[model samples]
Target: MQDILIVDGYNVIGAWTELKKLQKNDFELARDFLINKLSEYQAVTGWRVILIFDAYLISGKETKTKKSKIEVIYTKKSEKADQKIEGLIKKLQNVKTRIHVATSDMAEQWAVFSQGALRKPSRELIEEIGQIEKEIKRSTANTHRSSSMTKIQLDDATREKLEQMRRGF
Candidate 1:
């Protein structure tokens, strides 16, 4: 069974301070930042991540794209992200799947919960991402240290030959 995380894009952008600051200057930058962060989270967790952004005010059909192995969805005109998320929960929920919806909206939390999907508040998701990043850094440092300490075993003759080659002998 696989875990799925569905994020409400704007909701999280509003909730996260860094994203909110970027949004004040450039909306696209904020969205891109969120997508990149989510991509990293998806890579670390091995969960299927789907991020939904509201396109309800614009006139167009729903659009879905893949970014860094994660899904990015833009709701169609007149269709809110909340609606699309709920629809996705209904379509994807099953006994073998664990669905988690990330949003700070109370109404949305309740809605997804009632559909048997778990609710992860935006604040919680932010903290989880922070922890994951720290783990990655620690793991990378350990790997580097271990690799640098590794010694390759060589016969005496081979070692002498390598040393001679290094001196251009």
Candidate 2:
């Protein structure tokens, strides 16, 4: 079965306290942070994720997407991100596919639910992501060490060269 995670980009930024502060000063930074976190999550988990942003205010009305195996959408001038996500649910929803929408907006949650998709509040998503991050950190803790530190393993060639040099010295 296909699993999809549809996120309201701005709504999440507004909901997450850290991102909320970033959003006030630099909206792009908030968006980037969300994408970076989600990108890591996607790499760790095998869910198809799409983040929708409202670019309705931009006069040129651009629709750009990024492929970290995740989609980033900037909605058209005539439509809202919520509308786009609802439409996406209609297109992707099926008995075999599960769609999960993430947003703190109550009306939007109900809207996606009507289309047979589960809704996740931003706070809940944030908490979940935090847990996942901790897990990743714990798992990767010993994977890398400072370059100047002790060598856990050395190449055979380097070991042989060092042995020869030591004998000559």
Candidate 3:
């Protein structure tokens, strides 16, 4: 079974210095940036990523949507992100699923840990993301280098035939 990663959206944004600054200027951009980065992480890790945002400022029902193949959820006005994450952990917990919640809130971390779900502090999660990004970069560089280093040697006859095909036929 695939592991699940539950991210506290606002909590992470507030905890990350760059994201916090970006949020001050344009809140939507910060949210979008977080979503995009998480989507990339999800693609690389092959884990089920669910990002939960609190709707404390807006009056509406909770909403769930998929953006870039990642699940994004906004809690109802009465519900907070932590509550939504906790509830999801409970529901998704099973022998086949390993649930991990990412949040900087101490109380929330303790609660999740007590519930048998692993907790990742905001900083640690951010570092893990950085590592993933670095690994992707390294692998891409290696691929380019290896492809350039290794050449497919074609004999004169084969090369002439391929060139003739390209010309016509």
Candidate 4:
């Protein structure tokens, strides 16, 4: 089954320490950071990510989706981001599709859950992101583990050179 993630953008920014601090200084920075973070999460997890942010006086217009390999929506001026998320949950959910919603808002979590969408708190999402980063680092490391794991032996001449260096010989 294909996995889909519907993220509450402002909610996540408010929940994540780094994002919250960035938001305090620059709204654009926070917005960009959220997009980049979601992009990374999508790349690592192979999930379809859709991010929603609220707008005022949304004209009951069709959602404007930014396709940067992920869907980003600025709620059509009148709708709250949460409302848009609920609409999306209704539209995207099916028996074969696994939908996960990320937000710290309890009401939103319950609402999405009632729609058969699973909920993940922002902190737990961050921890999972950290684990993904660590996995990526370990997998990309240049260190030679193959030889050590097999207990391969070093030649006597190489060992002697190491011993001479240790004794200043």
Question: RMSD of each candidate?
Answer: 3.5, 4.4, 3.0, 7.0
Off by over 4 Å in 3: 151-169
Segments in model 1 whose C-alpha atoms lie over 4 Å from true places: 151-169
RMSD of 2: 4.4
TM-score for candidate 2: 0.82
Q: Write the per-residue lDDT of candidate 3 for residues 1-169, one digit (tens) a residue.
A: 7699999999999999999999999989999999998988898989999999999889999999999988999999999898998899889999999998999999999999999899989888888888888999999999999999899899999999999999997
TM-score per candidate, in order? 0.88, 0.82, 0.88, 0.78
Model 2, stretches more than 4 Å misplaced?
A: 144-169
User: How high a TM-score does candidate 4 get?
Assistant: 0.78
lDDT for predicted candidate 3 compared with the true structure: 0.93
> Per-residue alpha-carbon lDDT of model 4 for 67-164, expressed as tens digits?
55779888877678899999999998888899999999999999999999999998888788778878777866634565457774789999899899
Compared with the true structure, all predictions reach lDDT values of 0.94, 0.88, 0.93, 0.86
| lDDT top scorer | 1
Model 1 scores worst on lDDT over the 10 consecutive residues at 55-64
Error of 1 at 130 (Å): 0.6
